[model samples]
Target chain A: MKICVTATAEGLESSVDPHFGRCVYFLIVDDGSMDFESVPNESFSASGGAGIQAAQQVLNKGIDVLITGSLGPNAFPLISSENIEIYECATGSVSEAIASYKNGSLGRIEASNSPGKQGGKQRNGSSQKNN
Target chain B: MKIAIASGKGGTGKTTIAVNLAISLGNAQLLDCDVEEPNCNLFLRHDMEEFEDVTLPVPLVDKEKCDLCGDCANFCQYNAIASLPSGVMVFPKLCHGCGGCALVCPENAITENTRSIGIIERSADWSHVDLWQGLLHIGEPMASPVIHQLQEHISEDNNVAIIDSPPGTACPVIASLSGMDYCILVTEPTPFGLHDLKLAVDVVRQLGIPFGVLINRSDIGDSRVEEYCVSENIPILMKVPNNREIAVLYSKGIPFVTSLPGWNNRFVHMFANICEQLSTRAAE
Candidate 1:
């Protein structure tokens, strides 16, 4: 199962990048195994649809799982639409997030916690309702 | 004369230079074309008098009269429309709103729908300068449309119109710089600054616009920017030293030329030089 991993802002631990806005790092893992390659999310400038483009990359790669500290409302729906399962509130290193997923220690977040304004609720998988 | 201040990278002091130049010129029109994050208004502090909503036409499909023939999707350059097995889907963000898709639809299924992308604001006083700013709503993908709306306010009779462009050499920057007499590229003296400066120069050259460089925070970085300017024969119009006073004034929403004395004269001289060059070009 391919996985997309994002670290929490508070859990960055390492030095932060000034150019890219408020991102720790993003990791895309394959097959739910330890084999994973880091995809640099720093290229997403705040002005452009960098975040949306990055999510498109993950979709194109057919990532099945997304392991992240916190997923913003903008990113959450894009991934969920592709039928990718989201595991939220997971923190620590990229390795730990994966390990938690494998061991089933990662708690199953209900679709209710899906990170939209309406109590994590979303209409139609596209999120175009707000637009 | 219309002047556009732009840079290939962010944090290069494009706003700083544009705001100061507009203030110094006294009878100028200032345009902030950086719709995504227009910081020039923060410094100008003008009471915004006019606000106009900027909209883009996205294709609205009427499925009733339609056979899902998918011609609309084929004609769209942005791939904004998708023909699924069920019906047509529109990705509003990706839509360029060229209306080509609507024109190509044989069944008359697609029509134009207005979507609000941003707003254009104008503020002016008889004693001071006029300020026009574009504010792109957050999550809006298109900025060029709003920039175009901001440009509509530029009066030909105005003595000077100074535009603060968005960062990067992109479509929005192109839209902002279009029809301008001169472009002043603000860049730092650092390696990254030099790298992006070359990009900005290439963009201006491609647009066939006259451009010069203003090296901001010039004291900190290496001489590469200067060397490149000399080698390329690109004029370095002015050098703003890295100073704490400038920073303090900027944070306090004060124009550096006004809050910090003596800088106004330098800006005046710079504007005179720009005017002289423009007049010479017109004469030739």
Candidate 2:
């Protein structure tokens, strides 16, 4: 399965961007081979619907799953509609987040998360309450 | 001739000027374009039994026809539509009801429907002048749409129309001033008043609508407003002194022209002066 992680930079060491739509880059990692490619988010500075536009970009890349800090109201519906599994992470590097996801310790976000929550709130799919 | 009474700042006598001027020009049409807080009807004994609903077209997505191509999402300028991973999302509040999404949908999944934003009410017995007002539903964000509906009342029935424009230099005020023959910028002589007045001046000038200033409460504040008008070569058409009597009458919803003796003639003269200025500019 292809996994996409929202990140601040196009590398494994780059910190995970809490925001999904306005993230600087999407680190697409092959779940089995561990090979990775980076796609720069083109709508990082969009005046409106950055999440909506970004979701379409991810869908075009045929992403199976998305791991990010938070999901906005606008982006949540798009991800859910495309049948993409979503994982929420609190705060960590891309590598750490992927490791947590592989370990089945991350929260699986069943529904849309709140928009751009910075800290002390449920962000990751593993830690997020299913309700 | 359409005259829009606009004030850069709130509580700067826009309604006062509008009601008085409309009454002064007894035969003219009075349109209260201040849909947000329409208080112009307070002074006029106008009936409001007849109301016309003002609506704007909002798009509905047809799931059977939708291929999830995201064409409508990309076409919406207001970012009201989005093709999501789970499904599609539509934020009706963000929609400006432009119907672009419906037009651009490749799959023919989008259909347009009308949503009422406000109502246009008319005075059944407008003997002196035909009075019309736009009343926007509370919490509705789009005032310009309602104002656009109110403007439909304006036609060749009357040579002149007096419009009570909403306060501020935003989209609502622009809607009121659009295609107007003249704008009466009612303002006070305060720092805040002058600051916002400059903003309104910039908007009207940018739109290329000929306008003049009417300094309400002219004697209460400093002379800076007068100086600014003089420097900008903007005509100061009238000066309304801040008086307790005028304020008292306003509280009772009575026009200053009704309470103050001979003020009707003054407003009549002011209207004549505005006509003369407009004609002079036309000739020039």
The best candidate in terms of lDDT: 2
Cα lDDT for residue A104, model 2?
A: 94
What Cα-based lDDT does every candidate model obtain? 0.74, 0.83
TM-score of the second chain in each model? 0.95, 0.97
* Predicted candidate 1 versus true structure: per-residue lDDT over B185-233, tens digit per residue: 9999998899889998999999999888999999998999999999999
Give fnat for candidate 2: 0.23
Model 2 misplaced regions, further than 4 Å: A1-51, A54-131, B85-87
Candidate 1: stretches off by over 4 Å: A1-131, B124-126
lDDT of 1 by residue, A46-91 (tens): 3333334445555556677876544444444555666678675443
lDDT of 2 at B256: 83
TM-score of each: 0.71, 0.78
